[model samples]
Target: MQPSHTPHVLVVMGVAGTGKTTIGPLLAARLGVPYAEGDDFHPQANIAKMSAGTPLTDDDRAPWLDAIGRWAHDRAGLGGVVSCSALKRGYRDRLRAAAPGVAFVHLTGDRELIEDRMAHRKGHFMPTALLDSQFATLQPLAADEAGVEVDVSGDPTEITERAVAALAHLAPPQ
Candidate 1:
């Protein structure tokens, strides 16, 4: 793809444990942009609910999505990458509405692999029990969505490389 100079924000998305968090910063660094942690946008109640192994309802996620949307909106033209479990099309739509130029990088992997990774993660509020709910909620990026899906089957660096390559068309030209 031919490169362009217009700056934009990329939301790295997927079900939990799909490596969105690990790949987002790597991609941002590769693209010479800043990175935001999507989880940081969550309110304390949301974190508490997730920590208790309860899957969040849409209402519970509204403020969190709005916060992330605002961040993306603010980063427009400045360029940034953020990690989020944007498992539903509606959530992504909300973000895109807030930041019209926002693109996405959907990290995907086998459920077994994701669950294994979740089981091994430390200090993360999300528990493995919520994996099924996340999967159930996931609606893969549709044909109309501005995004690319990268398989998270390899190491973080490898996945990041794949993401950088996949998303090159969206990045500003050097």
Candidate 2:
């Protein structure tokens, strides 16, 4: 695609502690768009389940995903960023259905690295105990998905920079 200044929605996606919360706002700021934290849209039941070290089922996450999708859909025309675990392809598809043309930036890293980060994290509902479940459910962006996968081995600033640079040329699935 030719260079353009059009604004777009970008889903900063990954499991917990991959820096979705840390990097999403930064990416949005760099893009000059509004940002939303996907966690804020989670229903209390979903939070309770995760907080209890329970892996949320697809049934438990439907509304939460819908809410985040709605937020993205509302801001799609002018561009925005939102951070979501979006572990499953179906979940991402739900978000995409609500807001077509939105792109994704998947933060990925080694399991040990992610678990270490999760273990040291505080004040988050997600427990490190459920990380394996998260990983099991995670579906990397498919060939038909519009996205880029950025390794989380770098510093947050560098990761954000990489996301911005990648988005410049990334194309949405047709």
Candidate 3:
């Protein structure tokens, strides 16, 4: 399925444990676009801090966000999906600056559910304790923002399908 001319950029953004990693690829596959995991761009030091249970400062994230933004801009030429926390409006703005027509897909769910998932998850740098900081830093995308918000509390397939449908609706006619 080719993307519409409106240029939809899926930003699988949310606090830790929102399943951005898991859902991003599925959404991309459904959309027939490549998927980019935002965590892949994290600097080693940032990974170390998060692994040590420390919350990253905005300074720690700026370079990473810039990289993701650039990646999004580059990939959007052919169209693709990218997963990122994009926790702040400033960060989203930076992403938008890189790709003017980029859109977001904000995933949200209950804090307790997210924390539970974080605790059980392995091989990930982010810790469960940092969930608070993530939520604290998160500034939900405005209604008018170029994006759709979906609750990720349900099954992964359900979440993906909903997001895909939402994107289809938001996308311009082919």
Per-residue alpha-carbon lDDT of candidate 3 for residues 65-165, written as tens digits (9 for 90 to 100)? 99998988887657789999999999999988888778889999999999988889888878788899999999999976788889997889999988977
Q: Every model's Cα RMSD, please?
A: 2.5, 2.2, 1.9
**Tens-digit lDDT string for candidate 1 (30-126):** 8888899999999999999999999999999999999999999998878889988889999999998888889889999999999999999999999
What is the alpha-carbon lDDT for the whole of candidate 1? 0.88
Q: Which ten residues in a row have the lowest lDDT in candidate 2?
A: 1-10
- Candidate 2 stretches with Cα past 4 Å from truth are 1-3, 172-174
Candidate 1: give the clashing pairs. Answer: 4-173
Where model 3 places Cα greater than 4 Å from the true spot, the runs are 1-7, 171-174
Model 3, poorest ten-residue lDDT window?
Answer: 165-174
- Better model by lDDT, 1 or 3? 1
Clashes of each: 1, 0, 0
